[model samples]
Target: MGDDLVDLSEMFARFSEHWSPKLVARLNDYEVKLVKVEGDFVWHTHDDTDELFLVVAGQLTIQLRDRDVVLGPGQLFVVPRGVEHCPRADAEVKALLIEPTGVVNTGDAGGERTAIVVPI
Candidate 1:
């Protein structure tokens, strides 16, 4: 279904205690998610699709195989398919993620940080 704005703040506020993800929107087969992230994520890679991370607030550092990408408010980055990456936010970071539906945050590597996608 197509939705505008989708009331991000209110949806985001609903899960203040959850560290996982909330579905924000869907464009064709792609899905957008809003998440409050802290600490470091595990090393993972999506073998089939590209993953986009857009900073909504705070800061984020994405560790890649060769270099690191540091993102701030209004900034975004795309980690291409099959590239190893890990996302880290020293402080609290809010972000919007866009990727094909069913692409897990942990990708092929699954563990405790695999976010449960809570539809908004």
Candidate 2:
């Protein structure tokens, strides 16, 4: 591991794209990422692993077929494997995503919005 600290605000300021995730750190097989999002995302599911979302700024709504899970700053939610979910934001939001390395952002949907996570 690197000796320097990872400042989230500084890392977030390095990019301006929406729905794209930037890698910040790694823990064993898991990766910690930061992403900016707005509007609606595609309905998708990760068949093999769960997705963890931790909101850092603004509000995020994880839309499940049954209900919507709303999250704010400092809040987090895990979308289980094989469960379809669509994330929406009325405005821009900054969030941290924790998932196994190589997991695509769009999961099984595989459309234009599928992001290949890059390091910040």
Candidate 3:
């Protein structure tokens, strides 16, 4: 089981929806997920957990209340707990999200864009 690998290419190929995150792997109590995002995302805050975003392909801009942080491929950014933020992309972007289990994607702002954690 430990020898098994999860291929990002294969997982990304199977999904095309944007903003929806799919579970890729788990370590201890943390979850590693892949998400394809484009356009503007909802502004929200995870009051209890910090969120990590690692850009796998394309570019991602995380909009914070103070300023914006841009991330290219191989780059990453982390939003601290209770910090309000919104993620946006000029084109389709593939990224990896690392956060604790049970942390909702939409954070405190619950709406239709909230991801349902697709399991692959």
Rank order by TM-score, top first? 2, 3, 1
True-vs-predicted CA distance for residue 115, candidate 3, Å: 1.6
Tens digit of per-residue lDDT, candidate 2, span 1-120: 255678989988999999999999998999999999999999999999999999999999999999999999999999999999999999999999999999999998998998888887
User: Of the candidates shown, which would achieve the greatest TM-score relative to the real structure?
Assistant: 2
lDDT score for residue 13 of model 2: 94
Query: What is the C-alpha local distance difference test score of candidate 3?
Result: 0.92
RMSD (Cα, Å) of model 1: 1.7
As for candidate 2, its clashing pairs are: none
Runs of candidate 2 with Cα error greater than 4 angstroms are 1-3
| Number of backbone collisions per candidate | 0, 0, 0
Residue 63 error, candidate 1, Å: 0.7
Over all chains combined, what TM-score does candidate 2 have? Answer: 0.96
In order, candidate lDDTs are 0.86, 0.94, 0.92
Name the candidate that leads on lDDT: 2
- Give a tens-digit lDDT track for model 3, residues 83-109: 999999999999999999888989999
- Candidate 1 runs further than 4 Å off: 1-4, 17-19
Model 3: lDDT of residue 112: 88
Model 1 per-residue lDDT tens digits across residues 13-104: 77764358788788889988889889888999999999999898899999998999999999999999999999989999888899998888
Candidate 3 deviant stretches above 4 angstroms: 1-3
